[model samples]
Target chain A: MNKIIFLLTAVIVAAIIFFVPPIKGLGELAKIIFFHVPTAWVAVVAFFSSAFFAAKFLRTKNFSFDELSARAAKLGFVFVLLSTVSGAIFSKLTWGAYWNWDPRQTTIFVLILIYGAYLTLRAAVTDEKVRAKVSAVYSLLSVLTVPFLVFVLPRMYFSLHPSPINSSGVEMDSEVVIVLIAAVIDATLIFVRLMRR
Target chain B: MKLFGSRCDCVLAIVRKDFLLNLRRRATFAAMMMFALTATASLSLSTGGALLDEKFLAAILWVVIFFAAGAGLAGTFDDEAQAGTLPTLKLYGDAQAILFGKMSVAFLSLVALSTFILPIFLILFDVGVEKIFLLLATVLLGLIGLAAAGTLTAALTTSAAVKGGLFPILLFPVTLPIFLPAIRLTEISFTPAQVDSSLLVVILAFDAILILASSILYDYL
Candidate 1:
């Protein structure tokens, strides 16, 4: 039953992604948003869940919760990596550069660093209990700052990246929005399934 | 024995002990100053004494301070950990107090290091700041953010085998929010009307959140 649901969502998402008409003004490039935004969304969700489980571990001192947190973080890192790559490609196609130090670009770079450090810290520790405790604290710390990095810091500067929904009164096409939402829901469902496994 | 009664006293005592230890050793601060001096010299020589953009100069100054702090701040808890005194402190001292004390000492060391280096930096780079007050506030806030972030990171890295190396890796990424706004503020200090005053609040918020979270998580460390 679970495998069926996963497969069903996966196929449906693929269909929505490819079949959706090209967004106005962006053409084929608009498809990048489907892949990029949803991956980034999943990454954010994964990191939050990682922190949630880390807090649970801290409170309960349960090793399983630490394991879960670690799993979630690992997933988050992969998703963030995917998001970054897709965003870069999107930038290269639309903005004419693979890596412009745009505010959004810089923040994503920092997010990569934060989680990269988390993984390295995990690898450096030998004692099980110590590793769990330290990494849990580190994840919590990362989550504490992630908001400031992702949301607040970007706003501190002018950005050239296109945001899906923003305060500037720009509206995404309804068709594109549907595909993007479907993509996000699909990525999140996969994440949930992967976590359970 | 009595020093641990009140939180303020506990924090002060730890800061005092750390300061005394720092004075006797005198290595961390000296190393940091030496680093800043060498980096500034390299910058001047590399530029061939040419006048540079004030904003670029501002960025370079913060980079120097960031690296200098990285060079020194990792040892905030190193001495106690090496001497096997950490367990005692952990057992008897309030964890939050230890965190505050460690962060305070780190902030002070950074301030002293900056004071020694800032004049040299200004002289070597031939840059003028029209907003000394703004620069001062930015530097002070940057130092607090560094100390708060570094203290917690230092505590975490104490048990690692390769401590110094892992310190910067853990420290730099987590402190990005602090660094981004700090460098921008420093740039604005160089040219007052270039940016808004809102980033000042961001730095303050970063310090507050990190300190609060560190205080809560210190017990685990």
Candidate 2:
């Protein structure tokens, strides 16, 4: 919990850096890198955690693991919602629109809906074991599309979002490279802290 | 010979019992059909028939199919729950068989409902026969995926504290990928000259995978 607070504080401090005067407009796009990207990264982490716990629940037929999996899925859904909203806001500022139906936007929206269903499924079923097993199978099945939706499909199709600097097959300017790396590290630290709780 | 005869009789008895119950409660089917017709008609009217455009029409058709399927699958276990017969059914028959049987009936009903709506959609939207066939085929494949996924999730959530809104919420997202390909195929089918073979293959692959997973995991549910 303390670690989570510390990480969250770091996020706030990062936000302050972007929001405070001197660095505002030109840096606002970079601000999105901090919160929006982390939300997506954490959502992915939460999904994997849910899957892991789901598998464990099925293997051992343990209710605790089932509960853990359900909780992780719930968290994942929240992060997915956050990611979508933040990404939309960022898109509006950078691209002059809130909703573009870009491949990234569309695919992530679908993913969010999928995870939303995952939580709803847990809430609907009364029998604990049946819920766990069924949800486990679903979580696994849904994960199969994540790779395609997040990576392959988006790139194969048209998207307004910038391709990741490393993967776009283009050289990155020194400052942009530094900011991107910092953003990733900061997001990872936040995720690690959240997971500890 | 005597043992096999008894087992066969038992399976038939169970199926017959389920069928009779379904037939007697025509309310469920009637309500679903009415819902589909009303929703489709309202959509067709509200759009001033602009929804007749293949792209817009396909989207509306899919939305209707989705909700109709939800309405049908939502009640799949309701009768069992109301009659308190699920435990009895679970004990007397293979749970897998029961689930598959229910799904098969629901899928058929959805197909029938789609049959009614498809013609109306094509007529209202001015879609060609070729596009209609493509839309119908895509809807069928998509329904199979929906029914399979929906049945399992519905069964899981049937006993939950709040089953009403929860079922659709749970079913929709898991079925979104299936929806995309269905939409794509409908669009492609509208323009037969530009049909992508690979997209069709992907939809087929998705349907097979979801069906297999749903079937394998359904018994546990």
Candidate 3:
């Protein structure tokens, strides 16, 4: 059942990505945005979910919550990596540099570092009880830190980077919005299907 | 209110005890200062005795302090774990006190290292401090942020099998809001022109939020 759902989602998403005309400003680079933007959203949502489970584990002292937290963070880290690499490729096409230290890029780099630290941290501990508690603490701290790094600090500076999705009021064509919405749903559903294990 | 007062006393007592303990051992203290000096010396030599700008000097200064703090702060909790005093401290049910105590000591050691590093940097790099007061304020706030974040993380990793190797990797990312703006504030301190107060505001805000978060989260560790 899951495989069939995944296959249908994949085929339709791929078709929309290829057939859709490029946006006015982005040209061919627009194709990457379909993947990049949705991947970043999944990563952010996954991290928040991880933190939620971490908080739940801390409160209940239940092993299952810890498992959920660890799994979600791992998946989130993978999505973050995908988003960053895709974003870099898109940046190279448009900004003439693969890494410009744009405000968004800086935030993404911090996100990568935070989760890279998280994975290494998980490996560094062996005691099951200590591992659960410490990683839970770290997961919460890292997630709390995301807002300052990704949103607050970036906006403090005058940035040439794309204005935040909602704030700049960049009008999207109806078709483009539909594809983005579909991509988000597709990415999230994939996350849920795998995380169930 | 009375409970809060006694907790503050406990925190101060821990701070005092830690200071005395560090004074007695002196190993951590000496290592931190020496490491900072050696790192600064290498930078001076690599620059080939040429003059450096305030920007370059600011970057090098924080690098020295960051590494020195990294070297020193791990010992804060690890020493307790080694002596088996950590469980006793836990028995007392005053984790906040312990955290504040560690934070105070971290801040002190970092400041001690900074005092030594600054004079060496000034002489070696030949960059004047355009506003000594501003430099002092900026470094102080940066140290508070570093000490808070470092103490919490070091405590979390205290029970890990590889605390030494894990400490820096875990602590560095969480402390970026400290170092990034700190480097900016330090750069502003070196410039003789009109200073950008915005960076200071940013650092202050980050430091405030970071310290508050660290305190709230310290109990979990």
Candidate 4:
């Protein structure tokens, strides 16, 4: 618990130093970096949890693995929602509009719906063993698209979001890279602590 | 010979049983169709003048399609539960066949509902033949994607205590990727550029993946 509280404190400090100060004339738009990027990172982490436990459940046929997958899915849903809402708010500040139906926005919205369905599926079925098996299979199958949505589709088409890799496949900005890596670590530690409990 | 015969018999038996049950419980189908018609009609009446604008009409049509699919797909599992047929069906034959049969029925019901609503849509909205055909294809493909994914998810969630609320929450996120391209395709059907094949491919890949997953995993359920 002490370690967890310390880690939480570290996250708060990171948010204040890196996110609170305005840089590059981004002003309020920069605040979204703390929320949007971390939420997305955590969402991916949640999905990976589902995938890992799904494989375990399938192989061992253990109810515990299934339960873990379900819990991860619920967390994933919250993260997806957070990413969406924060992204939208940022878009409004930067683009002067709340919703542009951009491909990135559209795809994230769809992902949220899919996760919603996954949770619904868990609830709809009554039998414990059966629900676990079915949902595990679903988590594995649905996750196949995660790569395409997160990486391929955004780059293939023109998007408002900055592409991490340029046309020649180079990093867009070193500072952006540094901030994103730190944010991912911070968010993942928080997610682990939450899920562990 | 005996094994094959029993398997065939089981498949036919389950199919027949589902069909007969659906026929007897025609009210669900009727309600779905009526809901689709009413939704389409109300939109047309309210936005009669706006129908002249193809872009607006296309957007509204897709909204209609989504809601219509929702109304039809929502009840795919209700009758099975009420009649106490799910457990028996699970025990009788290949779970894949049952899922396929149910999905087929849902897809057909969606197509039928769309057929009724389409004509009304054409009359109310001055859409062109090329655009209409493209939009129709989009709707068909979108419904297939919906039914395939929605049925499996719905089946999974229906077992929960508060399924009424949980159903959409679980389903909407899973189906969101499919909707983006679908809505985009419908919106751009009138544009000179050919329909986006990549988006269609994405939807098809998703459908195939979900169907395979549902079939292989449904036996566990």
Minimum summed lDDT over a 10-residue window in model 4 chain A is located at: A170-179
* Residue range A50-139, candidate 4, lDDT tens digits: 889988999888888888888888999999999999988888877788887676886777677667767766766678776787678768
Model 4 Cα shift for residue A73 (angstroms): 3.1
* Candidate 4 C-alpha lDDT tens digits along B1-221: 98767766775776577568778878777877787778877876776556355566666776777666666676677777778978777787767767877777777777887788877876766566466677777888888877877777667655566655665565555665566677677767855557777777777777777677677766655
- Candidate 3 regions exceeding 4 Å error are A1-8, A156-158, A164-168, B51-53
Evaluate residue B134 in candidate 2 and report its C-alpha lDDT on the 0 to 100 scale: 63
Best by DockQ: 1
lDDT of 2 by residue, A17-128 (tens): 7533322343545466556777787788888888888778777888888777777777778888888998988888778898978988887787787787787666666676
lDDT of model 2, residue A105: 86
TM-score of structure candidate 4: 0.82
CAPRI band of model 4? acceptable
Better of 1 and 3 by DockQ: 1
Compute each candidate's TM-score over C-alphas: 0.93, 0.84, 0.93, 0.82
For model 4, report DockQ: 0.46
TM-score for chain A of every candidate model?
Answer: 0.90, 0.79, 0.90, 0.83
Interface RMSD of each: 1.2, 2.6, 1.5, 3.4
For residues B4-103, what per-residue lDDT tens digits would candidate 1 score against the true structure? 4688887889999999989999888889889989998998899998878876888899889998998899888888888998779967667888889889
lDDT of 3 by residue, B104-211 (tens): 888888888888888888888878788888889989888888888888888888888877778888887777777877887788888877776877786777777777
Question: Each prediction's DockQ?
Answer: 0.65, 0.47, 0.65, 0.46
The deviation in Å at residue A5 for candidate 3 is 4.2
lDDT (0 to 1) per candidate: 0.85, 0.72, 0.82, 0.72
For model 2, residues B110-218, the per-residue Cα lDDT tens digits are 7778888778766776777566566667778888888777777667666677776777777776677677778777876777656655655666676677777766666
